[model samples]
Target: MNFFKIKTSWSNAEFILIKLCMASAYILVGSYFHDFFAEYYSILIGIFIITAIWFVYQWLKKMKTHSDLPY
Candidate 1:
């Protein structure tokens, strides 16, 4: 399913909680599956790190969002 297909009715608090949960899940899953992608894991991790940093910057710097926080 696509990200847009997910239903998130909660406000900012819920949004933050969801993000934290997703990040934690990523870390846990990656650690457990490290052996499966020993070489490709670095690329995956770099992309994840870049995406996460971009997300953080957008969230922290954005004062007024025309759409929702997730968008």
Candidate 2:
């Protein structure tokens, strides 16, 4: 049984903004509350970089597929 429904009309800008806000909030809160970053800094950085690259790749691919530029 499906417990929740998702809306897929979100734009790329909203996705990026939310991701940035959440990551910054997590880092800020974690630093203030404990040593979360001190222990997993590398892992977090790697994931952030990889995800950014993946997002750019997907965005570009989608744009190219839907381009309407005139020759």
Task: Specify the highest-TM-score model's number.
Answer: 2
TM-score per model over all chains: 0.41, 0.52
lDDT by residue (tens digit), candidate 2, 2-41? 6567546888887998899999998889879676458777
Q: Tell me the spans in candidate 1 whose CA falls farther than 4 Å from its real position.
A: 1-11, 42-71
Task: Give the alpha-carbon lDDT of every model.
Answer: 0.86, 0.86
Task: List clashing residue pairs in candidate 1.
Answer: none
lDDT of 1 by residue, 1-71 (tens): 69888986777876898899999999999899988989897798899999999999898677556455675
Scored against the true structure, residue 35 in model 1 reaches a CA lDDT of: 87
> Considering summed lDDT, which 10 consecutive residues are worst modelled in model 1?
62-71
